[model samples]
Structures are given as C-alpha cells and as structure tokens.
Target: KNEGSYTIGKVELEIKLVNRGHVSGNVKGGNFFKASGFADMFGNASKDYQPQTLIETPILAENLKPGESRRFRVVFDYPPYFKGVTQFTRIFAH
Candidate 1:
C-alpha cells in the first residue's frame, strides 16, 4: 500500500546553546552529571512528537560531595522554523 507519509525536507537553522561552564566533570573522584544529553529545537516531525514538562530545576545533592563543580541553567521554547512542524501539518490536512 505504501501508506507512509512524511515531508519536511529541510529546517536546519542549527541552534545550540551550551552553558557548559559545568554540567559535571571531575573524573575519578566522581561527578559526571552530563547524563546522556539533551537540548531542544527540532521539528521536521512526521508523527507523534510528545512535549510536556516545561521546567524544573533543583539539585541539592546533599551538599555535593566529591570534586565539586556544578552550575545548571536550562531554557527552552523551540521553534524558529518548521513553525512547530507547520502547525501540526496544518491541523493534519484540514
């Protein structure tokens, strides 16, 4: 049937913000909190693009032990192009 559909050929403004003053890095002593990775801004989406959980930041870590080095700040509200995947493909093909 070939019922596959997706069209967003291009939308690469390439926006990246790194306040990597310290996401975490101390080595041996321990404190490598750059867990996995994440920083948003992308929507050439085809289906399902779940987004919820706006903001929350609070990491005391019982007065951080080991080699200390922590500074956190994350901001997000992506959409400089693809207008949120073309407004959901114009409301799913009207």
Candidate 2:
C-alpha cells in the first residue's frame, strides 16, 4: 500500500489595526477533498477521505500596531481520524 499526504495551500488573512486602534478582516473557506491521487496505472483512485464541517473561530485584535506584522499561531485539536492529504488551514488576523 502506498500512503501519501501533503498540504496543498492555506487560508491566510491580514488585519491592519489603524493608528486609531481599530482593525477589520475576514476568514476565507475551501472545500475538503477525499482521495486526490491516482491509485494505479489503470487511472483508479479512492474517495475515502470524508469532508468535515469547518469551525468558525473568533478574532480579537489586542495591542497590535499599524505597521507591525506577526505570525499568529492557531491552537486547536484535530480528531485522531484526520490523517494526511492536501488541505487548506485557517490563518488568524489580529
């Protein structure tokens, strides 16, 4: 059996808090794909990778600068059943 996985892309967002201490932004979404690779030379594939509903996360911009940029780490628990494949994750804005 050949098992392979990779990250195809990511959902990134940037919020610039103006000097007035206010910012605004939104999170984009994407569709989840099950099996994405060819199974064999006969052009066969699998679709066992079930799609899951995406969760909405809240954003809070606290103590951010107008020109300063920082990397926001997203902390969440993934179900044990989620293995490997191409997918896009969420990027937070502050």
Candidate 3:
C-alpha cells in the first residue's frame, strides 16, 4: 500500500525464511476496486464466482499512490497432517 503522496513503483517484497512450513510458490498480489472489481497485475478480471485476483510474483504497480493499497496473498505448504501439539510459524515481509 502506498500511503505517501508520491507514486510508488518497482515495489518488491521478500519473505523471511520459515522454520516450519515452506512457501509453496511465488507471492500473489492484486487490487480491488468497487467500480472494476478485483483484478490482477495484468488487469485480468477475476471470475464473478471466485472473485480472486491474486497473481504470481513480479507484480509491478507504478500507479499505486496515496490512498491506494494492493492486497497480497501467500500460501504455505506443509509436509503432511499431524496429530500432535499445534505448531506455529512466523512470517516476516520486507
């Protein structure tokens, strides 16, 4: 999200290493507007039923300026299901 008045461009995000689960694939991000609905970086509209606009990484949003925010979704894949103490993992983004 670009809260500043200047336009933000070439934005990149790096996820810190995880001790438990692992990142499944590249991060996905998109923008949602009431007029146009959810759309990916490529400007492809999401399905009406699904309404998911998250796309693979390498997203460039030079147009994101003040009051404009982008949404990102990350998925962590685990080895398998386990019936033991609940495990926790902390994710840090930069």
Candidate 4:
C-alpha cells in the first residue's frame, strides 16, 4: 500500500512455482503471469479506486514434472495517485 500521496516506486517480486500435480505439464506458448494492484485486501475497487495492471509477461517454456519448481521475477511500477489507502496485489497464472 502506498502511504504517500504520490506513487512510491517500482516493486520487484519473485515467485517460486511448483508443479505438484500428478502429471507433467508444460509452460509454453502464451502461458503468462500477471500482477494486479487493488484498492484493498479483499480485491474490491470503486470508480475512484480502480484496479491497476502492474505487470504481465509470458513465462519461459519449460516442462515440469511432479515436484519440479521454477522461479519467476517481475517488476511492477506502482500506480500513481493512490494515497493513504490500503492496497493489495494479486498474481495470476494463465
């Protein structure tokens, strides 16, 4: 959450993904990870507090068997004008 009146700065995040499913899967083609900024922890927003697309990028193609894991790094340039409000971030894989 940005406690300041102005945009704080860029936030970098690292995530570790593991394939715990029984079958092997491949991360290829258009598979991607996205990060979204929300107004609150519940992921709700109003007209004045809209959701922001922090970052979105395609993941490198890799075949992961069960128990295999991969690391991903992402940088999000925090949105401006969100002031003194609680903020939340959510990551999605598709």
Best by lDDT: 3
Number of clashing pairs per prediction, in order:
0, 0, 0, 0
For lDDT, candidate 1 versus 2, the one ahead is 2
**Local accuracy of candidate 1 as per-residue lDDT tens digits, 1-94:** 1122433222222223222213232223333223332423442253544332123233322333334434544344543322121111110110
Q: Which lDDT value does model 1 have at 21?
A: 18
lDDT of 2 by residue, 15-94 (tens): 22111101122222333332233432223334554323234353433344444344556554544444432234444432
After superposition, the stretches of candidate 1 with alpha carbons farther than 4 Å from their true spots are: 1-9, 23-33, 37-94
Best by TM-score: 3
Residue-level lDDT of model 4, residues 1-94, one tens digit each, is 3333443233333333322211223334344323332334456535564443233444432343334445655543544432222234443322
* Cα-based lDDT for every prediction: 0.28, 0.34, 0.39, 0.36
Clashing pairs in 1: none
Which lDDT tens digits does candidate 3 get at residues 47-74?
4332222222434354677778877666
When 3 and 4 are scored with lDDT, the better candidate is: 3
All models, RMSD in angstroms: 23.4, 20.0, 15.3, 19.4
Please give the RMSD of candidate 4 to the true structure: 19.4
Q: By TM-score, is 1 or 3 better? A: 3
Worst 10 residues of 2 by lDDT: 15-24
Better of 1 and 4 by TM-score: 4
